[model samples]
Target: MPTVPRLACLLLVAVVAGCAGTDTSAPSASNEAETEYDAATVENMREGTYNDAFESSYEPLPATPTLIQDATIMTAAGEPLENGDLLMRGREVDTLGTDLPVPNGAQVVNGSGMYVTPGLIDSHSHLGVSATPQVGPHYDNNEVGMATPGLWMEHGVWPQGPGFARALAGGTTTALLLSGSGDLIEGRGFTAKLIPARTPQSMKFPDAPGTLKMACGENPKGGSGFPTTRMGTANGLRSTFLDAQDYRERWDAWLADPTGAPPERDLGMETLAQVLRGDMLVQVHCYRADDMTTIMEIAQEFAFDIRSFHHAVEAYKIRDRLAEADISASMWSNWWGFKMEAFDGIPENVPLVHAAGARAIVHSDDDLEIQRLHHEAAKALRAGREAGLDISRNEALRWITANPAWALGIQDRVGTLEPGKNADVVLWTGDPFSVYTKAQRVWMDGALVYDRTDPDRQPRSDFELGGPRQH
Candidate 1:
């Protein structure tokens, strides 16, 4: 027989010992002991301390009250304002309007003829985990196993990746770093603020919901042995969820009566159980429309909601269904024909989804693409206009800003220029939809993180210190 893991063995022993205790009907201290034990167990389950070992250690930088005057402001929440002033009072937007009085001792910026908008947010990225220079050891975004829900994107995030600086330069202040779609259930993804730091945890978005990175269709089916076909993929997912349900039931039983001993902790099942409990968001990499519909069916079967579908090339075909389910689509602007499933992709996919009353976002799965997400959104906007769709510059900007933040479950904090939201603002050289425009200045939590005019403000990874290299 195979040897049991140490924790499992210990739990088995505890169960046997607890079962050997004498039964007592009297309402004595024994009943109180049981009640206290049950309460502790329930607390443990609710707090989810088992997964807290990788909690975020991020702390916002010291805020400086600053004011930008006479600039066009695209709030991403409404229409654009002309010659507006934005005040950032210590890590949050204080006010935004015309000719706002500068506070005492506030740093002032003359934003004449410039544009201000919320920092761009990428719904799908593999920056830190994949790393720059593209070497074997740096490719930690995927694992070999087919079912490895125990892995987390944060553990593999290399904080020194040069791509992070490039993304920041492009006004990408927040991003969702996801695991590669090489497995049926790859792992958990993480939301992070683009703050330069020594550790990944220091850059994590505080209190953001955990995201499970799942894959369907060609990617997971091609290499993984068991899930060789579409039907097999569905079956595999169903079976895994079924096992997770059983695991959750066992733990619930043990928690109801702690004297009977606790169930052995299974990390993979624990992650899935969080999904079942609606504590974690599910982001799947799906391509075809049929496959996406099937995945929705599976989600219904498992009684969980899919937050968004990454690289959903055919999402336009099922936009109504997605809207009804309240599922968002994180898609590329114009990529297609590289694979069989992506053959039916259209340039107007984003606008079509938006027209259907669904949340549509433009995402970058490639490192180079992440830096120009605004340009990608622009391309989709133009495509929509050419197709006779009524798309505006402000609405198109939401494809990169507010929409992605909603998909990542961080819209309440960093997606808009609201007074109570974080001061993740970017000043642009011109119209952000134009190719000639660039991010002149970028701020995160009211701190000047990047300035195009000052070389000192630009952060470079330690790896880029010795020689000139391409990021």
Candidate 2:
């Protein structure tokens, strides 16, 4: 017999040791059968392959103690610092101050005219699943059902998609790659560090919180499934949540007793159950204010929080309410009028929400748009300033950095140039808000991933008038 897998051996040992105490009642025919099944369930749970599977295997790239000197630093946590030195030791920001002493054995780069900020984040994106070549076979964003809480978006992610490299070159380090909202419940979203890897597992951010993708407006209803109308969609979702509650109760009862087999496993219901139990965050794709209100009511009934709403064009109308509930509005800067529900999109949506004391995230749902997320945030910042909101450049930068990081549940790890945070940072050639600026260098987890000055490190398709950046 082949040696038992390490996990299996440990699980077997636990089972033999009666960790939960195998049923001790007199073993009648039915009792024995139930006890055996219960033991098997416990073993599978311990193995972790039967449930809560596909754990991340991500490892940070090799890094060195490096200092980027004399740059304008926007931390996204406070006012910008001028002529500051940022030191990255190992995989985290070691220090940020003016005239910092260079650490021993640290490589130093002069960043005289560059601006450094936390790498941009897109809270709502479909980069890997939408695929770069844009062919039918490459497109794996949407599945065929309206109720597909069972499907996980990472399974469909094309790791080789060229978009990941392009996104990194554009200064985006982390992105929440969501399932296409073609289904009412398009399933779970995957948060990834934009690393070029062979599989999504390698790109997965370790210990990142999970999120589910749901839709309340036009996108989901277009599918040929149970929910063809908005009312139908609402009822369908409510019904699913009710079923998830029942499933959770069943599982809970088994854990409380462990005398019999647990309820039959359900791929779809299990995901919804995780949502109900608060193990997963829920982000919805909604445009109209009324539709968002409806989802809010459902959330209240279900006793779970809505993390954010993607493509919420009319989020401005309910900005106060959203702020009160602490729900983030992940939106495009100004792209609107392509559909009926999205027509109300105003350029000032992000800042208006921010002014109301709510988190406002600027996200890119399109592949091309993902590359210019900072530009999108800049546009919104200008619009908000023009509207007299008194927003600062640092605060506007948070729309693309800190706010989106919070939405994706990775704010503590990234979103700011602070000590004890991962060095996912971008060095820009000019003012990051200016259209003329380009990302001069990027470092993810302290590893220099892109350097525009180094032809070997730059992306091949970085696309200037010349083969390489002339500016």
Candidate 3:
């Protein structure tokens, strides 16, 4: 699992606590004045505890530490393990072998004849801001500018949006919150923990590297009175990336020698520099296979990675190249015929990608469909079988879990029920692949964030006044 630096973690905690009330700024290098808060005055504030051995000893055993035993573990690798035991502690997998010693404080959850995999991760979603479109203040997705790579998508995220809750109920734990496709260089996309909290800060993952959300083709060009050709879209993206390259060089020079006043910081340039430095990932929304190749070739020219191609309906045509490039394809199970460009899409798209040994993901771009991504994967699996392509049920499960996690650059942290990883797990009532299977419990960071068995545990947005009823 990727580890966030200690300093970054401390800064994040301080930023979150500052939301309560305070200056929130850290002490400076020159004038380090100590500020104190009176404990007696703050009666509700609890004492803080420090554990030097948190990683080794401070295993966060769940309030009801459930031990799931004798299950068909779809490790999302190659084969399923028969009769496996997964020891979940706090928000991570404490143990995942056979016939191990169950801890004293653990509650056993009988998992005989059940399937276990990681919670699904959606690589592409416009759920929260596009949730039925009530009004302006309620909608904060997709900035209108042509180039806004520096902007953070989380700032515009509506924490209480119904989509977040619905996705969780559907078995998604981690999601990449993205800006809508309004510009060629759409702003940043950040990974978020799908849990209900009072603030967005409470839900943002601590160390998930921010990614730049870029697009090609019709969405960016010819919206009203602009570049109506494919050349325009390609050129626009090229110009932005080239500028980003220059911006990175300037920042590096400034960082090397602080001789003069630093150049005024541009949020877009700062984010682009992260991409140039290979710190941030890139998620491009392109439909045609040719466009995918074009953007990827440009990425090679710029010397950065194209993490995943979102909505690549024609990806099956270029599955060999995608595998060679080591890029994942996030596509709908069989969604096609919506537009002329996407008319060539086929049900075999995912299966072809899988057959070519490339990452195939089934993502829900729609708010309603996102809740059943597992079923979507199953549909694709059947489609592949009908096409005479052999795809295992365990590998099909990766369409949502391991594949999407790998796409968003977070597979190591929460992708599988691997030991020494975050306990972000989901327990299904029956076979997860079956249509009747539903996520009974969803745990994030070892906390029972979503429990279908509990009425009050489900998340309800404050803005869901006249919205549709949720499960």
Name the candidate, 1 or 2, with the larger TM-score value.
1
Estimated TM-score for each candidate: 0.90, 0.89, 0.82
lDDT of 1 by residue, 29-98 (tens): 5445443354654665643554456668998877789999999999999999899999999799989999
Q: By descending TM-score, how would the candidates be arranged? A: 1, 2, 3
Model 2 TM-score (2 dp): 0.89
Distance from true location, Cα of 348 in model 2, Å: 1.3
Query: How well does candidate 2 score on lDDT at residue 73?
Result: 94
Best candidate, lDDT-wise? 1
lDDT of 2 by residue, 1-471 (tens): 555665565567646653233343444656365563455566554222365468788888888899999999999999888999999997999999999998889989898988999999999889888887788988888887768999988999988788888898899999999988888888989999998787899999898888899988888887667788999989988988888889878876766666665678888887887788787889999999999999999999999889999889999999999999999999999989999998888998988999999899999998888887889999999999999999999999999999998998888999999999999989999899999988999999999889888977864432222455567
lDDT of model 2 at residue 15? 64
RMSD of each: 6.1, 8.6, 12.7
Q: Best to worst by lDDT, what's the order?
A: 1, 2, 3
Lowest lDDT 10-residue stretch of candidate 1: 18-27
* Superposition error at 129 for model 2 (Å): 1.0
Worst ten in a row by lDDT for model 3: 46-55
